[model samples]
Target: MPDTFQRLYELIDTPRFAQGGVPRITTRKSAEDFAPRDEGLDVLLINTPVREWSYPNVLPIGQGYVAAGAIMDGHRLTRLDLNADRRVPISTLDPGYDAWLFARLDEALAGEPDVIGIGGIITQYAQIKKICAYCKDKLPDVPIVLGGGVASAMPDFMLKHLPVDYVSQHEGELTFSEILHRIEMGASMQGVAGVTYYETDSHGERTAIRRNPPRRTMTAEQLGHMPWPLRHLWDIENTYRVNPVGHLNQGRKWNQGAPESGGKFSAEMIASRGCPYTCEYCFSDYLGTAYRSRPPADVVREMEYLHYEYGVEYIEVLDDLMLTSYKWALEFYAELHKSGLPKRGVEWGGTCRTNILANDIVRAAREGRGNMLELGHDAGLRRVAYGVETGSPTILKVIDKSGQTPATIKTAVQETVRVLGYASCSFMFGSPGETAETIRETVDLCIEMDYRPEVFFFTTAYPGTVFWQLALDKGLIRKSVDGTVGPADDGIIERYLMGLGEQGDAVRTNFSDLPDDVLLQLTNQAAQDLNSHNSHRHPYQDGAPNSIVRDATHATI
Candidate 1:
């Protein structure tokens, strides 16, 4: 066996593994033996800190879904949102930063949770590791469960590395609830669907990993019945005051062209799940290949709740693709018009495909008011962002951007800006076939659109994406064993994940034919060129720290 797999074997060979039972891997340091509580399980769900500087600190909607499911199953849920805690210093350089995080964890553990759950995206691997290690050390007997993109993408890697008992794969709402139910009943997790767990032998030693069958994506009816995300668990007012919905109003200028709406607060909502297209670099399939949406009236009702409860003036629909079908968009917008939020000065924005935006009917709807694609000067549709990954037609095909070409991208962005007065476009560099000429084409297209774009300097090959497999095929990602074509076990994979968090916009791997230095220089120059066109440049675009600062002195812990 390779050294990495050997290390993994040793790691699992612990006292916890020896304490085998229905829910194995629970060995308490204290004298008391582990036992399932008769009453409801005290579940603690943590929303790990994302790179707050790059992204806004919105409500933990994903965790909220999981929490809602657990609550419905008679489990007590306590949420710890590390991202929304302004008391914690933002600077890792601060001396008390690590101590502060530990202290916060200690406070959260005061409830003595029966099972601890944590989650984040692939870029938050390092932070998730810190949280898992801390929780395991503090409560040795308590089971730790991980979910979200990190666990769904690389279940085996996370199971081998982190001190997690189980990984809730893919859509976690149903899976996590079932896991809790099984544990409450003191039943084995062997047949739990959409979960990855370790199966131990009679001697209580872990023999192998067992991944249950994937849970099917929720149907439209199921989605509509699903409970609303438990947003009340979070500090909503503070999050709005600090983060302020950056999707449409990044520079707080999205409303500059429209009439002065007195609304100040903001919130986020999602009306749909999954995307129809399987872009090479995206992990959309993790949510399943099918596109599912909630009822239009139900989504509009949630908007009304946010607007009234949180005094929200703007809402950023964070759906992967809100406008999946033309019919869905029309129905959703009709409900929005009926809610009268637009007349009440509540504006919202979401992502849409280039093809959908380029349609004449869609454009006309956007140009007028009281319709789905409303883009009137005082319209509720304040902004629309396009995932125009590249302007190079060759690279477009390379990434499998369905039905989108250079012309369609140009027309959609140009028309959006023509009607909305501004539109957000995102671009990425260093794909499998990226070249110097292709990089220039992307930059030139951004300039032609006359809109500053969010440019990601490196094309990260997130696990479970086609880009990741391509990287492995090209030897950009290497495994521990020689001549083995599988996921890397040797710390290479972990290091790659850590690099994603640490390097930020800096290049981690050169997927393109261009050399590393050449790619970096070209990407940096492209960002500079794009920055030159617009007066206001984003901090990430120029590789600078954002102006938002956290209070370090409030480290009361």
Candidate 2:
């Protein structure tokens, strides 16, 4: 199911909404004033909501500056510490419910664009469908295209059901351009690689969908050549407000002070595509094993543009695996410092394998104004994990976690903490061959790290992984919470979908050596113990964004 839409999927996240979920409301009372319709561009791209960010009490603080743990300072938090850092929603602080986004789309569409493409992964599938429904009624003549991992994986379901006329799959930059051109020229879409479309049968009924072979993996040149939309496309003037949290660096103690004044924003970018490590549960297979990244010069230029043009103070680097090569990382920092954006006083960080955090590389990143990181903490539990997914060495072979071992992981974690100073670890529970001893091993590691905040996840095989195929082959799926497996594929699909779409839901799809109930209990208890640091009291103890259209100065780092 890997498709051209992988890039689109990367830009999307699973926070805020359950997978395959949609907002209860659709279409404002008014639609004629939508802005993007008037942008006069050939194509309009909509990066719909469920964007990865943290929100207050109800929303999970999956990724936030406040997740940075403040020193206990001999101050044990009471019941009310959580609300002390409560952030006002941008919706309430500005316009509500992404109305601003719709407003911009309306303005662009008002300019009479040739085509409109909407992209999101499973997290936003239902939302995408809802938007497509509204778009169909509003812009009946404009050909609507759907692209992203959700489209690639669910082409049939989307193309057949949703109002979208075309679904662009795997690596969409080239395919999307061609799609727009073909639509404009009235050319047949037969040969367009990495696209799926439907033809009308003689009776005017939708026929079987057509798919083209996937295009080659994206290259560094190709990625850079693509419209680097640092300035264009995004409604930055409106949405790129600064974070209320100051300068946004780690070790900055939380302010019990009033939420600060506004006029700020944070931006995200990727200097690269594809992670080098082959963590089996990840969708890296879809990304192509070959890692590709932009030139350090290009990365720095974009950072400069974001900082100067957009007033972006903190930028999050969104590479799943960053710092893969020390030389590449060094070049990146050297370019940044020489380029003087380091002098611009911007802060940046990323989530990547701890193995890449060589002491020198970490030193360079700090020297270049980089701070904060989410390292691959899986390697630290040598006795309990390999790349963070197995307890038994035998299971490592089953999961195909090659090029990694306990010793290597231990060294990686040690080096990361040595340079970076802090780490937030998330690990898998309920893996094949798991046992009480293995679980205790993990607990020991956590304690060794000083209960250095962790999240334990129930392991389930989402589609498009070596793990999924293995589970299917070995019949580890359950029909219901009660662990029923039937003769048909319905339960299997149900279990898989739940795993993919719902992160909070526990899935027990591991081999029979370990029972789901026990696995669930272990993870729950571990999380409870780790969270005694008053997880609620420290909710992203950072700050929120300023204005929806624009406001807020800093965020918790």
Candidate 3:
């Protein structure tokens, strides 16, 4: 969110500003009054820190260098992705962490910035209260704005609680600009699009209003025109050491030297904005449904720049599909082949819909080795899961996704194997009406498939998805996460497995009770079983933490 805001501010300087998520990893840290740049006071972004679950370094939480690169690029209009813990383990701190964040915020407040922006994610809702308390403590005089996925998805909840100066729901760029403009010009925050805030006349009681901000979708061409991200504004370099994932090992160095040997110099390139698939358990739909693409030439041009200017050897096409259109994909590969700019070579990969697989697309994907293809096989037991929610049709209708049926998935897999030789198949186990039997059915179907594929037991519940909202509304899950799924060390795998597998059955039979140790044992056993059967490599073992993660007591887990 800060990255986005910073980029936007650079483009228009419209009294708008962006910041980053607050660090929640330790209690020793504290927030203070922010320092001022030439433009204005710095906005401190805060969020929950990771202290749990150590596995799968893929798809890392991008921060620091990655964010810096994005800032250097025009892609980021408003900067965010400050704390790069992708699968952040859930952990809680005594009031100290909050106090620190508040202290830092107080310091920023002392500078009397035009407006303070508070960015929150669904997982960080509980932690946000502390941020609010600190903001009020130090800068009660300044206005605070809350925005981002968590706030937008549940505006009513944020408005009711939390000490936010204003909640900017939905896409916040313009709404934030309007709010900032109002604050700077001494105008009323009324009519600021997509914002939820307090009303002065109403005695500081929280108020909710629907402000219609213009939808300012940037084209790939237009993106080139935006000011590069302001990397200098963030403590990016420090966060890289903290990111659990290994995104850094993949991308190349900026010295224009040789590619990092063991791990390729890979970077995620968002060729297009939005996903065409609306899988119930996926996040693509929430990001935005509007499908837009960057010109292949422009993208290739950037690739060359990265290759020559910065010795990037591999580029991961982070787009929903690198081969959405066969012609486009082929042309992109062919251009790179002809450019000879990166004569050394480059490799890359991205998510693809199995149903859209084409021979040409597969052939193009073969351009560079170590390239991976991610296919969203949400459910192996399509029929059962599709039956429970009955939203499959709606999803298909809305997102126009292919491969809802077993036959299509098989074909897609076959095509992937034929073209890419290897692929990552994502699988979701539990859903609204899912049971052990149904889940087994899905697993069984995967075991039956001829292709050896990578698989993950993707949980059905999470924020920013139709399934999560449905689960919450149906009371399928507890309203608040008790570090069970939120914290890094909360035993996410154990919690989910104990609820759905053999141990879960055992616990149910034994008075519906299960110990954490039992659950952990069962979860590990299940993971081992699944790993052994599917021939899928264990993500936990690959580049896993070599040492124990340190705790406050000097003990490592």
Best by TM-score: 1
| Winning model by lDDT | 1
RMSD of 1: 10.3
**Which sections of candidate 2 miss by over 4 Å?**
1-44, 51-53, 56-114, 137-142, 154-163, 202-204, 230-265, 285-289, 358-398, 471-483, 487-502, 508-513, 532-557
Q: Tens-digit lDDT track for model 1 on 347-370?
A: 888888887766644556576633
Considering summed lDDT, which 10 consecutive residues are worst modelled in model 1? 22-31
Model 2 per-residue lDDT tens digits across residues 158-251: 6776798898776554566566546645776887777788876778677778876776676675454433432222333443333322223222
Model 2 — which ten-residue stretch has the worst lDDT?
A: 65-74
lDDT tens digits, residue span 1-557, model 3: 23233433234323222121311111011111222233332344443332223211222222222223222222222232313322232223433444444544555556554455666445555555666666676667766677766566656556656677677654344455455545644767666656665565457554444444434554555433332222333432333222222123212111111222354444344566566656665565323446666666666766665455435555555455445665555556556666664346554555555555533335546854212232211100010011111112322332234555554566556555554454456443333333444444544554665543333332445556675555455433432223222232223322322233211111111111233233324323434555522212222223331222222322121
TM-score of each: 0.83, 0.67, 0.62
Error of 1 at 275 (Å): 0.8
> What TM-score does model 3 achieve against the real structure?
0.62
Q: Give the winner by TM-score: 1 or 3.
A: 1
